[model samples]
Target: MPAPAHRLGLGLAAIARPAYITSGRAGELGDDRDVATLRDRSRALLDAAYAAGVRYLDVARSYGRAEEFLAGWLADRPGVTGGEDPVEIGSKWGYRYVGGWRTDADTHEVKDHSLDAFTEQYALSRELLGDHLGTYHVHSATLDTGVLDDGRVHRAMAHLRDRGIRVGISTSGPAQADAVRRALDVRVDGEPLFTSFQSTWNPLEPSVGPALAEAADAGARVIVKEVFANGRLAPGGEDGTEGARAAAALAARTGVPLDRIAVAAALANPWAWRVLLGPVGTDQLASNLAGAELTLPADAAEELTALAEPAEHYWATRSARPWS
Candidate 1:
């Protein structure tokens, strides 16, 4: 069955900033990395996405003004501004963008999952996004960060949850399953703290699937991100990888682009409440949305599962992808 329109979201990770880790960004975005240029580009993509039936938008403090760009788009768009056509906005904190908008910056973002970091970043996000922000997540929560164990952070997130904002965690690294399991156990005021989970889940790294399914069973909203494996499953992506090659072969046989196939794979996950699309432009967004309409053959779906790589190896390759 095809994924519903409401089951898809637009993530502003690549367009809100000039340089991102997604492959083909250099070709898609070109040399125009200025703030104004990117802001305009972000708004254009947001407009296109909303028109294409995407009602959920994801951003982050570490995404180099992604929250600000989204705020601007919300303010400028008439129907969206007045809630005539409301869209759910989800943003992450705990990471500060230190790239200074430069592609060659030694460090792009710095993670600090401390309560102090949450207090400061949450205020900034609310100042910009205001009532439009429906959900807030810990940018990249892992066991090492101790965020799951931090009582202060849990209290703060719980306070937000009480105020009608959905609290969640966006997991990263190879131990995503571990993080999701840990977060599921977190509670505040004797109640579950996190009700939303955004994590990377693609054919190359399907390690988090079982844990995410458990989260869904626990009544948590499960959002799947990085479905393209940081663009490795997209058109002109790194086809040398085994998973990418399998996806490409399937695409060729089915007459569907590799990107769409990737999207279809993510949408096929019964536990996935929403699949995020990180397209650089309108054309890419259209191509990705088409995947929602695609229902892969059962044999093809089984073949894709065999392409799963070791979680550690998959993450290592993703880490080496330069921010271009």
Candidate 2:
């Protein structure tokens, strides 16, 4: 396999860290045991993605040294991703890793979407990723967080934009639609500061789709994440649950993997400029690429929308997932 033959407009998430401490399929999949091991795996993953026609890489400051891992991988494989057009590296600030690679840590990440947090994380990201960094996003933007409303943060983002780096925000929680709408209103001297937006849009939580379309119509590129609901759409996950059953039924009817059906549903949204697939290995990545190319039947797509859960309930279940 020389990688997927078609462009999927996909991005890779480098937060496969917790696999270091646990033991199982997921553990093995996320196993970034040490800096050296992580660097090697990161390079392999990135190589696989580029060969497969993926051009975007998404990471975060709190993703347990993801910036460092990506920088090392890029340094080793210069210009290999596609000659004139190289990979685009988009990373997020506003969170810091406190897990210290511990499996028993009470809190693995701490969020702080303040101006000062951006100040520190921005410089740190620059120091680590150097010239490879493209876009910097406010990690997990929520309505109450004020990252989108703060004028000072907007000015700071303006400064970064002046330097030619695209600015954006990643949203989470039940209020994702509200946050995405608010981000669209962010202006730096009467011009929109955000050129990109990433949000969760899976069968479990599809309410944000319209807002994402609004952002796209406003000239911002929309990237869809969590299309599988953080693994809920995969086999061995929520087997007896309604969402799982629905996805499985669709998969069997369409002759696609459950994960593919989940991702394809998200990609079917016209507003999604890029749909991220965070695969733990090359095999999973390949499957995701295939899913990205699928165009689900009109009936199947509409039925998937009916599986949407209340945003509150969906987020509650996601939050309850133990950090692996």
Candidate 3:
């Protein structure tokens, strides 16, 4: 069966539903794992997201300490879920397991979007995700990655559809939008492929937004990522700052936090069916949810758009560094 449209909107999910670890690798913070301890922390994260009315869970085979943690704590998430119908979990395939642990030691992951690898990995992910599955995507996809074009992604995706799952592509480029459009041309369970997709679409980086609009126009539901610009929207840190004052202004005018407006701007786009979110802590999820109110008074939206765009049109030419 197809996923319900009601699942869109404020119902978007937060990625990597757990705290530590990649799929089987070490956690990002490299915390040593005791299944019991992780189970406790994972439950707390999911519980908070659930209580906040989140209905989607986005995970990847490469999220480090996240997917396996979710699988282990699957049944135990009620403490954090707060009695809601279990969340709609969406995990990705297309990478070698590397022993199913979070590849924590490495700051960046290697890309492997091959067919056989994707097929094999997805099968196992299904076993881990079980019944709560709603969407499955290509993890960390780039335009050059063959995952979308390869027969294997579709084959494995087709297999998942046979099992009654909805499949989509997770992309890092505008070209993936084209791939999604192409993927939708084929028949999988009588429905076109890539019913849903995730991509980075924050205001500071508007390159993918138009592509996403094209996808939505073509019938696929688009889920936006990095609405916070991956921490760049926060009070400036390592990266350069361009939109802080504008971000702060929007926050003050709307009574929404700067962090919330980062997300709210993405949510305000009619083409975006849902926006994927991530919070480091349980309370952070609440702050992220503040964006879900989905209200962007017309002037606020315009100013925020202006804030995101610079005099030169993009921030690269500006004298300032990127916002952390």
TM-score for each of the candidates: 0.97, 0.92, 0.75
| Tens-place lDDT digits, model 2, residues 1-324 | 233323344443434455321112364454446656655666677778888777878888887767777777787788744477677889999998887876578878899988899999999999988867888999899889877889999999899898889999999999999998888988898888988998988888988989999999998988888877777786445536687688778777878787778777877777888788776667777787777667788898888878898999888877777656
1 against 3, candidate with superior TM-score: 1
The candidate with the higher TM-score, 2 or 3, is 2
Q: Taking the candidates one at a time, how many backbone clashes does each contain?
A: 0, 0, 20
Give the lDDT of residue 99 in candidate 2: 79
Error of 2 at 211 (Å): 0.6
Model 3: how far residue 263 lies from native, Å: 2.0
What lDDT is reached at residue 185 by model 1? 95
In model 2, where do residues sit more than 4 Å from their true spots? 1-15, 19-32
Cα RMSD for candidates in order: 1.7, 2.7, 6.2
**Cα lDDT, model 1, residue 217:** 99
lDDT of 2 at 194: 89
**104-159 per-residue lDDT for model 3 (tens digits):** 33323446777766767766776776666678887766557656566646766787
lDDT of 1 at 51: 80
